[model samples]
Target: MTQPSSEKINDNTSFQAFVPAVSRWLAWQCEMISEVKIGTVFLRSNTANNNLKMFASWPENVSDSIEGKLYDLAQDVIDGKNNIMPKMTCDAGQGDMVYDTTTLPLHYNNKVVGAVIFLQSVRSEDQKKAVFQLFQWGCALLESTLTDMYEEQHKFHPLVTDLAKLALQDAPVALIGHQICNLLAQQLGCKRVVLGTMQGLQVHTLALSNQLRFDTRASHISEMEAVMEEALDQDQAILYPKSEEMFSSVTQKHQTLSADNEDASLLTIPFSNAENAIGAILLLRPRNNPFTKEEVKAVQYATQLLGSSFSLKLRDEYSFLNLLVQSFKKKTQPVFGTGHL
Candidate 1:
């Protein structure tokens, strides 16, 4: 893989080490476009800072004039242009090299976070359209990958801290579950959130966000449990209105639940300990608002952070004699009968 040039504009120490990996990935992606002679990407320093800095450039070396042109095109992309096409000529060793350039903006959570510019050899109108289509596809892939990476690197710490703090609160296990459900619903923009724990082979709903009491036998409650059980049975997260990427996992229950609830989008994540899955969380939002990969990951992380803590709390809820008797029964099972001690 080619390395980016050291000459960076608006260089920030925070992104110094981070930029290279992105640069390499972008370089590789650009190389995939057979017609592209040069490619460059520019990314925002941070959400608060609108400054776009050169992140990566293919070929590792390019004339200053070519770099300047790409930078201008990238700026235009950042300014909200959907697409820009321009013709330019650069002198290669042989002679004047004519190229056609295309630029596209990259978005995360509906916000433009970066831009990519590609320079392809001049071609016919149809061929240029094909190259443009390739650029759009490349931008989509880049956005998805970048979103996951950015969340893992920058958002994980805050998510862990917030969930861990909730787990540490001096509260009952049921109340803690309620808090977690509410927190996740609020954080993930879900209209409702439900938390359920595995009891024997069945998952029991422990808490529902924004609701102090709900009928255990209610139709919606049962539907929610069914969705949770579906995910727990498979031991994997399930997203409703399922994406093509999740085709292997069955989502019938999730679909039914969503359909019954005004076609809302749904996501169920089962969290487990070392032995097996202990509980699952279900999040629901409007049908138009699907869960993003980052939000799904955040919920998965929350379950990992809180699953064992909730299990321990539930154990502590048992009477001292009950726990002691259970422990004794386990210890003496080989020597004595196993029927309720």
Candidate 2:
């Protein structure tokens, strides 16, 4: 069967001119390194219902693993909680070979619109970094493309509305904090998300998703505190692609993303209400893709929604109205196991 005309044609008239731009970036990257194949570019679309659909990929040689676990990973990236770098190994007619997969989360406004996935059949360490850098460049190109797409389509309200909602409760401020962390995990497509609380000048680990199950005791809160301080100073979302490498010098047990490792990325979203940053919401992903600006905005909006809900709870009693909001918070939190809240 003939593929859809929209498949991989990156023409000016094509719905996605982003592909050619990405190809140009990849080509430039390949020039920098000899062993790089400009792999296919995959687009994950979010229709009017907020449901995600993976569009056909470029090159056609790169097969999509977006069926089971990979599909879930894509969802996480769309929800804004993914940090895992997906692998690109496939049977190359001749035999099975290793291919490095690099992915970048795509967004329009503050919502995750889709992603661009690249597969490079190179193993050299330097080549891998060059390919990774190309992915980051693709992200930038995709961002510009999205701005054009949004202008042409001019529909963004439904996109933001499709973002998952959280349940809020007047159980306790700590409970709200815990649930917010989980929501960040769910939205960001990370394996685990943790919340750290500030007590005086010291920050304490408050909550984490069950999937991660990291020992707060194992980490020094000072490290997290330092990260948050940096985020606050920057006044923006911070991405920690190689936590282990950056924080390794600081003597903290940091997590790193490897080609073999399933989890791909680590994210820290500073959780400051109208007042101050009570703590931060962390996210995890196993696919090798950095969070997109749209994904970041979705996360920031979700945190703002949670903060608003928390503020409402602080003002009123646990009446039916409050319970309604709290239930939304519960949907995002993992209150079933760790009975801390």
TM-score for each candidate, following the candidate numbering: 0.50, 0.36
Lowest-scoring 10 consecutive residues by lDDT in candidate 1? 1-10
- The candidate that wins on TM-score is 1
Question: Tens digits of per-residue lDDT for model 2 on 1-341?
Answer: 13224432222222344455445534433433334443333344333334444443333334444333335555666666656655645553436666566656775544455655554566555435433543453355446544545345332323232321232332565555566566556655666665665456555666666533455555444455555555544445566553422232221222432222354565666654555554555565665666676676656655544433443443343365679877866875675543543
* Candidate with maximal lDDT: 1
Per-residue lDDT of 303 in model 1: 70
Give the distance in Å from residue 241's predicted Cα in candidate 1 to where it truly belongs. 1.0
Clashes of 1: 0
RMSD of each: 19.7, 20.7
Pairs of residues clashing in candidate 1: none
* Model 1 regions more than 4 Å off: 1-157, 319-341
